[model samples]
Target: MLLMPENKDQLVSVLTYHVVSGKVNAADVVKLESADTVQGEQLMIKTTDGDVMVNNAKVVMTDVEASNGVIHVIDTVLLPE
Candidate 1:
């Protein structure tokens, strides 16, 4: 979806849904069922046959460290409903 800031709240919500507060690595991610985002929503996490999925996106890369947190690259853009 094209997230234009037509509604500032909605745009921020959508963006925040992509982020979780703490630094969650791939190892830690597979252990959890869901994670709470900064947007005040829970993101569903699933692992099947050694494949990790966050929401509807497949995790492509993991353990990318940043100044504040780690980054996990996913195949698709996730949209919250």
Candidate 2:
């Protein structure tokens, strides 16, 4: 869903879904079935024949470093119902 600036609460929730609290690398991610997001939602994570999948999105890139945490780029935006 498209989140406008006016929808601050929802925008934060959606943004948080894309992020985890700490640095989670590919190896760590592959080991777990789920990761808890800052938004309080559990993200479904699994490796499909070696390819990592998160929810309905494919993790195209992993281990992108940032001061606060890491980033796993996905093929699609994950939305919570």
Candidate 3:
């Protein structure tokens, strides 16, 4: 479902759903069929026209380092069921 978080708790859930464990870069990301998000849902990964998609969100940028983990920017919001 396409979720537009209405409150703080819902917002948090949506954000966490976009995150996956480990520092899987762009190359490794395409090799996988799916990945487990930190929020406990599995994100389906796909490649089409040389672009990587996580669920319905497109991975526009990758390999950004963070203090806690790495970040891969996605074009759309992701939420758990």
Candidate 4:
């Protein structure tokens, strides 16, 4: 993911939401309420019945990890507005 400096806060939050309580699958994300990222930002996660949301985006893919951290593909790019 490419996060610009201005979007650092949102980036951190988004990154955190991607992390699993355990080694997660895409389905596990729906159960998260929040997460703290490596960059020291908190991400708000939301799930309603059969729906799940992260900030203002949806997780289209998940559990893609790297040596540095994990990646969850979101349908929309998040920015600090």
For candidate 4, give the lDDT of residue 64. 81
The TM-score of candidate 3 is 0.80
TM-score of candidate 1 versus the correct structure, residues matched by position: 0.88
* Clashing pairs counted in every model: 0, 0, 0, 0
Q: How many clashing residue pairs are found in candidate 2?
A: 0
- Best-to-worst lDDT order: 1, 2, 3, 4
lDDT of 1 by residue, 12-50 (tens): 877898999988888899999999999888989999999
lDDT of each: 0.89, 0.87, 0.84, 0.64
**TM-score of candidate 2 to 2 decimals:** 0.89
Q: lDDT at 54 for candidate 2? A: 93
Which of the numbered candidates is closest to the native, going by highest lDDT? 1
* TM-score for each model: 0.88, 0.89, 0.80, 0.53
The candidate maximizing TM-score is: 2
After the best TM-score superposition of candidate 4, give how far the Cα of residue 54 lies from its true spot, in angstroms. Answer: 1.0
Q: How would you encode candidate 2's per-residue C-alpha lDDT over 1-81 as one tens digit per residue? A: 446667888888788888788778898999999989888999999898989999999999988887778888999989876
lDDT, residue 31, model 1: 100
After superposition, candidate 4 runs with Cα above 4 Å error: 1-24, 65-70
